[model samples]
Target chain A: MRIVLHIWRQKNGRSSGKMVRYELPDINSHMSFLEMLDVLNERLIEKGEDPVAFDHDCREGICGMCGFVINGTAHGPVRGTTVCQLHMRHFQDGEELYLEPWRAKAFPVIKDLMVDRGAFDRIIAAGGYVSVSTGSAPDGNAIPIPKDNAELSMDAAACIACGACVAACPNASAALFTAAKISHLALLPQGEPERHQRSLRMVAQANTEGFGACSNVGECEAVCPKKITLENIARMFRDYIGASWTRRPAGASRG
Target chain B: MASTFQRTLRFYEATIGKKALIAVTGAILVLYVVGHMIGNLQIYLGREALNAYAHKLHDLGPLLWLVRGFLLLAVVVHIVASIQLWLMNRAARPSRYVRQSWVKATFASRTMIVTGPILAAFIVYHVLHLTVGRFHPGFNHELDVYHNVVAGFRNVPTSVAYIVAMALLGYHVSHGAWSMFQSAGLHHPRYMPIVQKAAVALAIALFVGNISIPISILAGFIR
Candidate 1:
């Protein structure tokens, strides 16, 4: 099946970019979107052109690295599938496939389709950790976490940081990302010591990093590859307000 | 703004969806409006008092800039988010407006996103046309911003625009106030309707207060 391709091309980050058209006469219905791109790139390379650059790793959709907006919707029209997992069979023959990188001031295009997502990392670093003693891994059963809480923790722990939630969000908020991290720890035993501080710090960091504030749009979870819920955001909000009120001035820096 | 390379590699750089940005920015603007109103009440003290109060607020300088900048950022984010969501929503299921019998919802709820940025854009022009003295075809700095505002509203078309926009503003804010709480995850079933009603009342109050400036000016009451 021949499909018309409108793919973004740029020399580098500083260079002006434009959509370059390509025509593939024979496309496998069974080929994943990435695989189709691969075939195109192979053709481009053989013909002495730069291969289309995009972000992808662990093409199985578990890793959040690979995704570009397909025909406008992030990861395409099918809900909750990564670009790598999207198959050509879902599309019809000769459909004009318009592809572009995620568009946001906070997310600048790196090359053709890749975006800088370090803001997510900074948000996580601000308070996504439980300050555990760096010695040995704790035995799984040692912490007497409540069964319900333990389950909830795993649920929040499901965030893959793909920025799908951001893509899906009307605000591009990392609410789901931050919520997953905050909730993962918020539901745990070791996390209690710094739960409030974590929420306040994470929320502040999230704002400072330029992610849109969470408005509980629920689109994040709806299109989330991991299906992270907006409820985690609620939990984080509770922790933030709770932490702000309960927290006392620090006596000294961490030893 | 950082370079494109910096954005890609930085990893954390992410935008909130345009709709959510609009919602949150609208949330912040509501706050600013509330604060503005409380301060504007100093107007009843007469021009000397109001000007003095305004001068004092201006003296806050960088702090004021910081707050204003954040608010502006929120507004930008909100507008962008609204457009993105509206586009996506339109694409997901194209909606068309038609006059027909249907189950009715609040006017504010339906048009909040549509009317919101228009109001914000008007506010920008309002400030510019009156305060900055740049947007007006007839600029006279000798005519104070207050005077420009007064005369501007006296125009029939301008006054009508304010009234229509203010009605939409009321509708948007009414739904918005309740939504912010919901976004924060306040879900007690029994309290939802009550909360929504309170939001509606607050919306009405805000709309009335804001519209008063234009309406009063047109009525020859604020001269």
Candidate 2:
């Protein structure tokens, strides 16, 4: 089948991006989307043209590095699946596919379909960890986390820091991504000391990083490859609001 | 509580500013409307009960003026924010990527923006007719609250406007209420649907309750 692709092309972060069109023929319907891109790149190289650049590491969908908006939906037409896991058969033989890098103020387009998602890393750096000293590994059973609680924590911790939530959101909110970390840690004993403080800090950082506030459109959950629930967003809000209303002594703003 | 500076940025002109303004103002309006409805329920407790309650509110002296000021600010913010949002949406994406399917949706949900201002106009007329007694020629300000409301509703135009405005207001409140829960991030999987239903039910209740006042007056039950 022949497919017309309108892929986003950018020389660099400083350059303006636009959709560049290309036609690929004889594509295998069984091949994964990334594989079709591979064939396109091979053809580009043979023709002495610069191949399209896109983010992908594992192609198996666990890496969380691969994602782009296809026809305005993040990670293509499928729900709860990454672009790497998307297949060519989702398109028609002569249909045109509009592909662009995930649009968010934080996720700046680096080149082609790749974006600089380092802002997600910085938000994590702000408060997304439990304090542990360098070398000695503690036993997991030491914390005595209940089975249900541990599983719930893991479910939230499954977020791979992909900006798909922000991409899918109407406001480009990173609340889903930030909430995932805040709830995952705040639920467990390991995160006890910083639970209240963590939600406040991460939420502030998310705003500082130029992400939009949550509009509760539920688009984030709809496109999340990990299928993270919007409930975590509520928990994060509850924590943030609770911390804000704690009523510290006067002149405490300086502290 | 992000920061004074951040809040200012969220207040001034920007995408965030407009949305924040809308949410803050909308929340205030909805809360007050619900409270107003609840307070008006005192009408069923007899005339003195309702009139005394109104007196207590008016007894706030200059503080009543302050409350009115805040409500005015809310109105300005809410209207400006909505206009900005509507314009931004128009500029950002002119056409839906998916086929537009708001057909099955109710007029109330689809027409919140239009109906909201109409409701606001109705509210202003309501205040003028019953509270100040300035707009209604037959209304006697010297007569206490109950007679003014009854006399105002006797006019055909006023009665029709009351019904139309309440209907639009109901539509705005229904969508706006549930949307607030989502905006505040209270929209969980299990709780979201319940919240939506409750918002709609509350809106309908207010619609029916408020409409009954004019209808009763028109039907000659409350002269």
> Fnat of each prediction?
0.06, 0.14
RMSD in Å for model 1: 11.2
Docking band of candidate 1? incorrect
TM-scores of all predicted structures: 0.61, 0.75
lDDT of 1 by residue, A125-194 (tens): 8988988789898887887889889888998887778886666555556778888999999898889988
DockQ of each: 0.06, 0.21
True contacts kept of 2: 0.14
* Candidate 2 per-residue lDDT over residues B165-190, each given as its tens digit: 87888888887887766544465677
- Per-residue C-alpha lDDT of model 2 across residues A143-237, encoded as one tens digit per residue: 68898888879999999877888777665778899999998998898897777667766776776777766645567888899999878887787
Worst 10 residues of 2 chain B by lDDT: B95-104
Q: Which digits, one per residue and each the tens of the lDDT, describe model 1 over residues B1-223?
A: 3454653333222222232334456778888877876675554456666667766767898998898789778777667656655553443222111111112224555566677777887778667766677645555575344555666777778778777877777777787887776654454546776987998898888787877777767777677
In terms of lDDT, model 2 sits at: 0.76
Stretches > 4 Å off in candidate 2: A247-255, B1-28, B35-140, B143-172, B175-190, B207-223
